[model samples]
Target: MVNLQVCSFNMVGILFLLSLILPTISGDCTCDANTEEKHNSAALHYKLGAIASILLSSVAGVCLPMLGKKIPALRPENDFFFVIKALAAGVILATGFIHILPDSFADLTSPCLNQNPWGNFPFSGFFAMVSAIATLMVDAYATGYYTRLHFNKQANAGELEGGANENDGHVHVHTHAVHGHAHGAVIPTESMTLPELTRHRIIAQVLELGIVFHSVIIGIDMGASQSVSTIRPLVAALSFHQFFEGIGLGGCISQAKFETKSAAIMATFFSLTTPLGAVIGIGISSTYNENSPTSLIVEGTFNGLASGILIYMALVDLLAADFMNPRLQNNFKLQLWVNAALLLGAGCMSLLAKWA
Candidate 1:
């Protein structure tokens, strides 16, 4: 027979394992904030509604602005478009700082991870800084590569002054032409110059990449959650969030003037990402475990990187570009309005953070 001391040690081991696997019966632990309880059915209902609202809002917001071809007021040339861009930039900024960054901090620093290295080192902020630096490197390199592709030595004299009037300038790369060995597919420039159009295209795609990652994570988060109180407020906040993002992306797409197919595909993707993520979360709710250290690490890392990308894009590509534009700067009144619009958008998203 086992001795009393040995039996006691075995029993303690079993209890310790049980504690790790099972939800705390009573305590302040909130790592499993989305665990299903009495509100399972209601939460699922709210989640479905969220899927619909998020899809519709994003689709409408993006499509309406893309209709700039049909509606003069929607075109980028309109002075009011600057205000919209500012508003969207603000939304993107708040999403990075308020909505996502804090969440990363929560996940990485959760009590569940008290024993992990994540608690010892500031992994989230470090990853975020790295992400921002990487984005800048990619942005600069891509622009330079494309710039060289578009300009010839003959046209190099007026490299900045890109136009066919420069003779050999027509020899420059087509937005749809070959760059290196890859599809030199380029943005169709109509009102805006080729360089400007290309920049917008790059910005749109990079921003989309960040959005896609962030969207899927949040979708799973909402899907895995089983709290009606959380899901209910989340729906409205997410809808508005999608709408604002859609508008911003749509404006970029419109400016880029991509092939009709490309534009539609992008719009569809932006609209569906969150809803799909939510569906995935719901499907996995039975098995989803946020308390797992691995899940926390992955989510926190991705959110941190995504927040960095978004913060960089909003500040550098969106707000900084427009704010410093000659037209907005030359007109102080317009600058004021644009600044006000940015504040309004940031304020709205920041306010929504309470519920989201």
Candidate 2:
């Protein structure tokens, strides 16, 4: 209960900080005086429709895996689940490399900014590299810290129970027993240890954070745009974008095996972020200048950071971990299929980038 409360508080704090920071970054700027103002009734209707469609698609995408618990074939132990996860990780990987990275490059290299450090230095790539390293640090430190704590707790528990054991050196071995079977095999508890579970939970949360940051920025841009032509294609593309991204995020959240409330919180949070960002963009549309120096710096920096986080999560946490799994490594056919699925997912997401 205390952990739940602490998590809830942390989430609230993050939301609050985002609320405060985005507005400051998105506020009116004096740098760009010749901004285009093309707001119209048609565009307003499109944006409103976009909000609804994106919301529904996001909700459906994220909920699919959660509801898949009822389907026997969709269970985590099944081969199909691995394929799905591969596709999802591919989507995330493409999102980071193909989609967000380019946007960061464009923003950081824009002509609106001063030509001193921004123009001379490849700030986008630098920031992205730094962000990636930072993410690696966070991933390593968090996993190591939690694993140490979990093992220490187990050690303490074992010591407390040491007095009751007949032999100090005799370790307890848990075995899997079948009700109808005469004999059962001893199975190692390492398959789903507590620390492993904790690691999954951490990955899910961090992945969500990265996705949410990017999603909100996308929403704000879409909401602030007044071009009907631009908004029309984006409405569809972004809907698909949110849907696939949600599937990826939902897959992680599902694997985390969070409690009902925690799962709901994660799903709801993911579902709402883009739409809420769109609403925020709409509210600030009149004053927000995308081409301004301040806006460029803020958006570019955030995009770079988000790109790093997603790339790290997809490559290190998701792809490497799953690809190197004993089951996948042992099965050549499954490996080939997963690789194909990954390419397919990456291709699909990359194609969407042409418009979105």
Candidate 3:
């Protein structure tokens, strides 16, 4: 987790530095057209409306899954919960591939960015691949480190208890590993262990980072635009699509099973980030240039990173982990439902992206 955060922050710094050094491309006379600051009251009204609607939708969608304890049907332990996870995973996958990745490509390869570097290479895809590898490294290292730490503590405890036998720690660790892997060739997701819960927690945090990154970018785009026609469709589209993202993130938080305060914090963070970004963009709309070299590189790079993290989590952590669980393997009917739910979610999000 620490490694992941560090890498992201570093990427941000690198993008910032590149933006400073890279020369802007003068694509056409119209490239300077947007530099003029014009305040439109109609656009402002729509933005205010958009902010309120998006906030309400985001809060409601995310809070729904967090209410699982009170609403037993939605609880993670329920067999139906896998269907929700599958749906969420599909939404995230589509968001990465259909929405954010394309946006990154457009931004990095925009006419406003120089062709020498930005257009010369597929920087968006390259950064996305790098981010995915980094996420994998973080996932593997964190799980491995925690597993070792837990077993070492257990070994020490046994030694302190007057040489209480625990198979010298190494053999016990091997046995535990074997037992974990032997569940009908399924991952032990249904069987919650300390390590499993910790893994879920990590997944929640990493997912939040990716979703929030993309959310803020789009929110800013909407907020900074002064065009009423564009903002109108975006207002409805963003509010509608963001609800799916909220549900996906909320489902992960539910699986993590954080305490009340921590869970609420995560939920609120997701619910507010886009709105907060909108507010920031609204404040700076006078000088904000979506087509500027600085904005393009920064937004494009972050979008690339976000796409990678989200894609990795959706494929490996959520879908693969849950689909391979023994519960789904043994229940053919449930498996069909889960897969269908995934398709439904992906299709819904993809359809909505046409507007957003």
Candidate with the greatest TM-score versus the true structure: 2
Write down the RMSD of candidate 2 (Cα, Å): 5.8
lDDT of prediction 1: 0.77
The clash count of every prediction, one per candidate, is 4, 0, 0
Cα misplacement distance, residue 231 of candidate 1 (Å): 0.6
Give the lowest summed-lDDT range of ten residues in model 3. Answer: 180-189
Please give each candidate's TM-score: 0.83, 0.86, 0.83
Per-residue lDDT of model 2, residues 1-356, tens digit only: 11445655665564455445555654344554445557567888999999999999999888877766687665566788788878888888999999998999998888777789899998888877887898787767877776675456446656766776645423431111122112211111234665566677778878887887688788888887777877989889888878877888887777777767778988998898888888877777776778777768878987888898899989998889889999999999999999998998899989988888
Per-candidate Cα lDDT values, in order, are 0.77, 0.76, 0.77
Worst 10 residues of 2 by lDDT: 173-182
Candidate 2 residue spans exceeding 4 A from truth: 1-39, 166-191
lDDT tens string, model 1, 28-81?
Answer: 446565445547888889999999999999999889889887888888888888
Error of 3 at 343 (Å): 1.2
At residue 290, candidate 2 shows an lDDT of 81
329 Cα displacement, candidate 1 (Å): 0.7
